[model samples]
Structure formats: C-alpha cells, structure tokens
Target: MVTASSLGLTERQAVILTVGFYMITALIMVSCNKWALNTIELPWLLLWCQMMIAVILLKVTHSTGMLKMPEIRIDVSKALAPLIAINVLGLGVNTLCLVYVDTSFYQIARGLVLPFTVIFAYALLGQPSSSLVLASCFTVFCGFYTGISTEVNVSQRGVFFGIFSSITTSLHAIVIKKSLPAVNNSSLDLVYYNNVLSMLVTTPIVFLSGETSKVMATLETEGFQAFHSFLAAAFVTGIFGFLVNLAGFMQISKTSPTTHMISGAVRGVLQTLLGYFAFGDIITTGRLSGIVLILSGGAIYTYAKDKEMQTTTKPTYIPMTQQDVDGNEDNERKA
Candidate 1:
C-alpha cells in the first residue's frame, strides 16, 4: 500500500504514508477472517517475514552498492544469535499465550510490559528509580487493574500467560536497549537481524508444533480466505510492523518509562476498536471503561513528558555523511 510506495523515503510525508499502510493492512487482515486472523500468532512472526523481504529488496535496490559495500564492523552472527534466542523464547511463549487468552484481554494485560521494562532496567542496567518514577509506576498498576477488570473468565493460566508474556517482552526490550550501544544499530537492522535469527529458530518449531500441518489444513478447508489471511499477515509484518518498531524505538526512548507505559495502554483500545469494526466483535462495557483509564493515563503521561522534554536539550538528527545517518556512534561524531 502506501508504505510500499514510500519505500526508501525518510520524510514526514513518508511517515504519513506508513500510517496509511498499517491501517490498510489492519483493515484487510481483520476483514478477511476474524476467527483465523485472531488465532494467528503474535505479529512478531510477520516482523521477521518483513525483515527477510526487506533484506531482499535492499539487495535488489543496492546491487551496485552491494559490490562496493562498506565493511560494517558488526558481527552479524554474534549480534543476531542472542537477539534470536530472546526473541524466539519471548515470541514462542507469546504465541502460545494467545491461544489461551482473548485478543482484547491480552491487549489490556500486555500494558504491564511497561512496568516490567522499568524493573528490568533496574535489575540489568542498575538504573535508579526516583520518587516521580515510583509514583508513575503506581499509576500504571492502577491503570492495569482498571483495564483488566472487564476481561472475561479470570483463569489462572490466563494470568500466568499474560505475566510471562510481559516478562519476556521486557527482557527482549532490555536486551535490545543494551545492545544498542555497541552495535549502534539502526532499528531496521536490529529488526532484520532478530527476525532472521528468530525465523531460523522458529522454522523447526513450526514443523514440530504441527503449525505446518495446521497451515495446510487451513489452506485445504478455508481456501482463499485462508490465503488472504496468510498474505495479509505477511504484508503486515513486512511493512507495518517495521514502521511500528522504528517509530516506537525513535520516540519511546526519548520519553520516560512511565510515559511509554501509559501509551502502551492504547494497544487495547486500538485493537478492540479494530476487532469490533472489522470483525463484529462485541465492545463490552468493561472494555469501554478500560479504554477510558488507558487514555487518561496516557494523556497524563504525555503531558508530563512533553513538559519534561521542553526543559531538556537533545540533538535532533541532521543527515550528514553515510556514516552519520543514525548519528548514534563514534563514527558519526568523528564525521
């Protein structure tokens, strides 16, 4: 869609096109088959698919550049190995968790990843928490409570799966954040490598878990509907998923963890709306209440962070040499 058309673009217009890409992909996927679509695994799978495609497209676009390619100092193997391990473990658990939890409930519960990231930061990075951060954390807890209250069937396993997903996601985030310094990786490269590694790891599981057989069954029984979902899923990962990661990585780190946490609340709202409008899924009273708390907290978090950023000085990226594209490394500073 718009994203595909805007490939290689890095402008405000490109960003808008990217949003259009996601909306179209979402609409198409949800409209094709809600039951099958909802049952599909985490969008991470699609993320990897997009990485593989992007790599191919990049190669095609830069065939001449490939011949004269700069010898990037990165150890692709080393960087990818740990990322793949964490991502596969996280995504595997997430995929299984999806089977046991409804999408809306899962969305609400996943907001807890924000708190988990703070905990992970404290534990892994020795990051100290201030009173303001502590207060924000408390707010997040309250928000989570309000959000999950409306979810149906409060089973123990459901709770376990949600918690597990949060922990893995938090760990994955920390791992990526820590790796950020040494590699000074682009979000595209980070995603591409992780996806490549995860796909390598997950391909075997796809066979072992009988996912392959299930996919075949889906094709045999559901025909074009199944095909459409498959294509939609692939497109989502290839295009929209990449943009989402890029935007979040670029934006979220600039804000406080609490602000990021509050914004995390919006996934449930967006997903619930998509479910209802696109698939005729019921918008329950509880979900409506949860959306309100989520939005309120997010608004508070954004307002606070905007005020905070206004008081700080951070350099905005100015395109320089090829080495300075990201402006995140010694090379960029040297240049």
Candidate 2:
C-alpha cells in the first residue's frame, strides 16, 4: 500500500503496520508484568540492566566500525536547544503521566493530541490548518470516546493524565517538525539525541534516594528463572523501543506533521485490539465504532488536506533534476 507521496504505505497498510508494531509492544509489556507477578520477586532493575547492555552494544558497534555514521552539523545555537528541550519534557511527562492513568482512558485521551497539535501549529508557528484537519481531530476524539465508553467507566485521573500526554506528545511533534529543516541530522542522530536527553532527565529522579539500588536488588534476589524472564523482556523492549522510535521519527520527518499525528492514531486502536487478544479484554461495539471513526477520520483528513495544499501551495516534494525519478528519495535525503 502506497500514498500519493510515493511512499510505500496505503492507508490500510499504515494502520496494519502501526498496529503490528504496537500490538507486539503490548504483548511484551503484558508478558513482562505477568512474569513479574508470578515470580517470587520481580526483576525491577531489568530495564536499567538492559540499558547498560545497550550501551555496551553501542560501544562495541562503534568500536568495530559497524555503526553507520549519520550526517551531523553543529547547531547548538539554533534548533537543537528547543527541539531537545521540547522532546525532553514531552517524553518525560508522557511517561510519568502513564503512572496516573489507566490504559483504556489513556487511549481515548490521546485523541485530544491532534487538536492540540493543530492549534499549536496555527497559533504559535503560524501554520494554516484546513477545516478537514479540524474535523479529523474531532473525529479522533469521538473515536476515543467510543472506544472507552463501551467497556470501562473511564477514570477522572486517567482522563487528566491522558490529556496531559496528548498535549506533550503534540508539542513533541510540532517542535521536531518545525526544527527538522535546520537540524540537518539523520534519524539515527535524532534518536540518539532524544534518548540520551530523556535518559539524563529521567535518570536522576528515578534513581535518587536509592530507587535504582532497590530495583537492582529486587532483580538480583529474584530466582534465576525470574531474572532470565525479565532479561528477555527487557531485551525485547529495548530493541523494539529503538526501532519504533527510529521508524516513527523518520516517517514524521518525511510527512506532514498532521499526517504523522493521524498515522499514530493507529497505535491506540492496535493496542486496544492487542489488549483484547492477549489480556482477555473484550472489545465492544462502541470500541469498534471508535476504531472506524479514527481510521476514517485520518484517511479523509489526510487526503482532503493534501489535495487542498497541493492546489494552493507546492507539493511536499519537488523533483529537482533528471536523476530524481521518484520524489521520495529526495525527501528522504532532505529528512
């Protein structure tokens, strides 16, 4: 499935790919929690240990000259500061908010991110948003409401935290999109920057007051079986986490910010389906209706908005020379 931009994704394909990515993530998370619950003591420090392992792998790859070098231009005085700052807060707040939210309501609340992003882009960055764009945002929220109202009496705290997450997530998208033109960094570099910044900011608080030590002790004292299960879970998570971040970020860099945001809606729907299959959560009619609304809204909005933009403004990608047959190669290089 492919889009008009000549990118290799049809609307349905996008949803399926996004769903597959997050469904696997949900399975990993659920399996990890179950393993923790059943074990004598949970391997709480497994994630940190996994991070250490990742650092080792990164060092080895770099030393062995296996890691691909990305194009890097120094721009500390320009977009780097703000982009890094926005993502740092955005990622941290989103992660912390999950502690206060339930997954069902969180999915619904994330729909709000579209509208917030649209508003921020318009008001702060002076980007024009079409009526279709606005409608898409509303439709996503409606879908979220449908999904949540069906099975659970959504909690107020979850709703609040979900809203918080949406806003931060939107801000993250807007900041990254706005800054991409000037950053001149590859996807790998962006991933490294975002992850390193997030780790630095999240670390002190997570580890202070002996939290890190306690978590590590829990993992060590746990039986070998428990520890191994945790190690496996952490390994899967770390690898997939990096892949998702890389793919999603690169996709966003090539596409419109709004389209990127809408594409991510598939994550919530997919996660819901995964919950049903893996966690014994039942999907109700209302939830299915919500999923339809989200998919429909995203598709309609992206097509309409792109059409409108093309008629009035330049296409997102322009063929500059005979060498560029398909426009996507240039877009990818630019991104």
Candidate 3:
C-alpha cells in the first residue's frame, strides 16, 4: 500500500534499499563493536579510533562537496558543550558495558534507553504522552527487567555501567533535541560537532584510563601481526560506525523518530540472534519472552505516537448549507 513517494524515497526501488541499509548498518555496528571489544580488550582506544575515522570520513565528504559542513562558532560550541560531553560519556560507558557484558545481555541492557528517554522527555522537556503510550513504556520496562532477572552469569559492574549509559544516552537525546535549533536543525551538523568534540574530550581520557599502555604492551608482546589485526578491526569498525551514523540520520530525516525506534527494536532482535549464533550466548524461554514483550511494546508505543501526531496535524473542515452561503453573500453586499 505504501509508495516510494509516500515515504519520500527517490525511486520505487529505494524504499526497501534505504530501510535495509539503515537496519543492516546499525546491526553490523553493534556486532563489530562487540567483536572488537572482546578481541582487543581496549574499549576506549577502539572508540577513539572509531571517532577519528568518523571525523576523517566527514572531512573527506565535505571536501568532495557531498555534504556541507557547518561552522562552529564560539557561541554555538558553548551551547553544545553539555550535549557533547554527555554524548561522549554515554558512548564511553556503553563500550565499557559491552566489554564487561555478554552481547546478548548487552542488547537487553541497552533496552533501558527508551524508557529513560521517555522519563527525561517528560521531566526535562515537559512533553507528555497519552496513557496508552505510558503503559506501553511500562511494558517495555517490564520486558527489560524480565531479561535482566533471567540473565545467567550476569556482570554487576556491566549492569551498573549499562544503567548509567542509558541515563546519559537519554539525556543526550533530550539535549540533542534542545540544541538542534541552535545548530540550524541539521542532524549532520550535530554529528560533525559531536564527533569533533568527542575526539577532543576522549583523547586524554583514553590515555588516562591506561588503555594506551595496555595497547603498547600488547603490541610489544604480540608483535606487529597483533597490532595489524587490531588496526584492521578498528578500521572496519570505524567504517561501519560512520555508515551507521549516516544511515541513522537518513532514517530519522526521511521518517519519524517513532519509525526509527521501531527499526531499532527490530535491530535489537537481530543483534540478539547474532550474539547467540556468533558468540554462543545462552537463550532461555524467559529471555525470548522478554524480547517479544520489548518488541511488541515498542511497536505499540510507535503506533500510538504516530496516531497522536496524525490526530494533532489533521485539518478540520466545516460544512455549510446553501442558506448559510446566501446569508454570507447578503452580509457581504451590505458591508
């Protein structure tokens, strides 16, 4: 029933292609990040590499005139500082969580982001949702709790970092929305600024955290082969990371955030399945049920939000009888 024009695609074939690109890139980004973390054991350094690559790719794209880069004035940079800080912190903690947690559990842990986003939206932005939306969010929370409850060999530290990551991620989203108007509502501009600022902020932390020493030691003991392997993994992860960001921007711009969220829910399922097949993660009945609940609740929340937007934006029409038209004509003549 949906056409390319209806979804703002370029051509008839592009609708599926765009959605697939977005979803696939997102899934690959998570899988590759987890793989890199498990293999290299340098989460911060790996993240730093990814950010550096993103910046380089952005610069190249700008140079080629594929994308326009926004100038960062002092005023705009100052306004965006909080968002940049929170974004960096959220990502740093998320990587740490991945390092400490199993990939399957990591997916479940990150599921907290949506509920936290809703809470922050209401608390900070004063954006209220209908009862159905609220109830759906509650269902999502229950699903996450169910997953956590049934998790075997759970890492407490990982869970702790995951919780903070969710909090920071939620705040990052809210701040992004608040700061977009300052950045001319360009998500790509925000991405550029965020990556640049994140690099500046993360460089010192990467060294201070002693990941640099660990990497150096590994290079010494394992030789250039190990270092080369790490570099290759980091490079691939970086490319995937850039694609993920680009695809995310495209997805959100072409569709609503609700649609983006629904895609994310689907991505989570795929990532969980990949974790099981690739990493031998244990999958239980309870965890499976939790995944179902989370996906269902997300879908419901998205539908509710979409319906609400439609209702709010729909135009109202008034019907007039011939007598009313005649009366208005007589009044116009008198005037």
Candidate 4:
C-alpha cells in the first residue's frame, strides 16, 4: 500500500501537499464561480446547485469506496450546526463579492480574513499570538487600506460583503477546530456534513431569494448556450469545492491557524496574478504594493511561527534495533 513512511516523507512534505491542494482548488473554484454566477445571475440558486452537486459527488465517491461516508447521526448534525451556519453565511457573502468585484480585486476585498482570524482566535479561543504575529496583522491591515484607498473601480457593496465574509470566515475557522472532534476528527465526515446541511439551508434560500424564478425566466428568454455554460462551470467548481473542503480540514488538522493564514496569503498573491492574466484585470501600483505587503507579512508571520515552534517543540527518541546494535559493536572493536 502507498504510505508516507514507505515514501520517506516528513511532515513538511504533507504540509506542502495540503497547502497546495487548497491553493489550487481555491484558485480554480473562485474563477469558475465568477463565471457561473455571471452567466446565471442567481447566486443563491447557483450556490445551492453547487452544494447539491458536491453532495452527490461525495455520495458517488463513497459508493466507489474511495471514501466512506459516516452514517448520519443526530448528535453529529447538532454539533455541526454552528459550522454549517457559518459555512452558509460565509459562502453567501463570498458569492456576492464575486458578483460585484473584479477577479483581481477579490483578494484585496477579502484580505482582512487573516487579521480577523487572529483577532477572533484570541478573543474566542483564548489563544494568544506572539508580538511578531500581531505586527504582521498590522502590516496586512495597512495593505488592505492602501489598496482600498487607491482603487478607482472599487465596489462598495462588494467591500461590504467581503467584510462580512471575513467575520464569518474567522468564526468558521475557529468553529471547525471545535466541531472536528464531533466527527471523530475525520475531515471527510466534516465535509459530508457541511455540504449536506448547506443543501438543506440553501434549498429554501433559493426559493426565498426568488432565484428560481429568475433562472426560469432567463432560461425561457435566452438561448440554451448560456444555461449550458453555467452548468459546466458549476460542475467543475462543485468538484473542486468538495476537494477544497477536505483540504481545508486536513490542513487545519496538521497545521497551526497561523500557518494556514500564511498559506492563504500565498494563495492570494498567486490568485491576484492569475486573475490579472486570466481576466485581464487592471493592475495599478497601489494594488501591486498591497499584494507585496500582504505577502511580506505572511512571510514574517511564518518565520516567527517556525522559530516559536522550534523552541517549544520536544524532540522524539527512536530506539535502535538489535541488528543495529550488533553491527555498531563490531565496528567499535575494529576501530
């Protein structure tokens, strides 16, 4: 069987893979969501579809034995309620941001997520951060202000939605740590529950939003091409959406919240650059500076965290086998 031990991989390798999975999936999911939302003009319904599609895909994967679904339990569902609530709200604002903001501006719009996460963590979880981490958050806040001040095409509503998302996101990250225990610390189970509950909540949201009516009206007035495009984009994003969910939990399980924030900062940089090329987004000096400062803060934060971990970490002892002892004794006599 394939395993990390057989491949001689350290924890760092696993960290890289987990971070990579999130970065790549997030980048794709955001772009696809932007397309799907634009083409459909029904954010709630589109999100509902994505959630349902993700659940279906999960079920299919479970059937194939690639992953097993935990049986539905009332206790687990109740424990997951808080997470599901935040997940729905967070995603709702995120889709709204995509609807109203430029692809490149997306990162700047949501840039406060890290700082907010730090603040929420300390306030709610009673986890204190180092001085350097606090300084990094200050730097990131500066970058956020810089970009917002200089951007001429900034969307006021998009910024509002982004701020709301930051709040939900901070809460979501903290809540996940608490909720994971209820799922036996299994990322897959959490993913399953999150999507399933989201579907239940979003079903009514779609109708209450009047999005279903809008979709049907548009379909009757427009050709099939746009509808087909929406479907395709939704499917692609739905798959990555599930993968990103799994990746998020897997990463949170293995890394500190600080490290996860750093990875997200890295992702923001890459996402900004890609959005520039993919969407032909206008890049200004101020915007570029914001990206730089954000990335620099993430670097500083990561270094401080590494240094802290090294000092606080205890070393492990590996016992040698009898064969190794006999060989060492013979070598000592020869010497």
TM-score of each: 0.66, 0.70, 0.83, 0.88
By summed lDDT, which 10 consecutive residues of candidate 3 come out lowest?
A: 315-324
lDDT of 4: 0.76
Reference-based lDDT, residue 112, model 2: 72
Off by over 4 Å in 3: 1-20, 306-335
Residue lDDT tens for model 3, 1-335: 23355666544245347567899998888888887876778888888999999999999999998888887678888888998888788888988998888777776777776787678767875778789888888888888888878877778888889888878866754566566666766768878887888888899999999988887787789876776666888999899988887676555434434445567778888988998999898888777877878877887787776566456643221112122122222111210
lDDT of 4 by residue, 233-284 (tens): 8888888888787788776655545556667777777778888898888989
RMSD of each: 6.8, 6.1, 9.3, 7.5
TM-score of 2: 0.70
Best by lDDT: 4
- CA lDDT, every prediction? 0.53, 0.55, 0.74, 0.76
| Clashing pairs in model 4, backbone N/Cα/C closer than 3 A | none
How do the candidates rank by lDDT, highest first?
Answer: 4, 3, 2, 1
Error of model 4, residue 213, in angstroms? 1.7
Candidate 2 lDDT over residue span 55-166, tens digit each: 4455566679877534334553345667766665554444334444433334555667767877787787777777887788788778867766775655566566667778
lDDT of 1 by residue, 149-257 (tens): 7666655566677778778877765566555544444544554455455656766665777666766777788766756665665765555444454444433222223
Cα-lDDT of candidate 3: 0.74
Which lDDT value does model 1 have at 8? 61
How big is the positional error of residue 290 in model 3, measured in Å on the Cα after superposition? Answer: 1.9
The candidate that wins on TM-score is: 4
Clashing pairs in 1: 46-237, 50-238
Model 1, position 75, has a per-residue lDDT of: 74
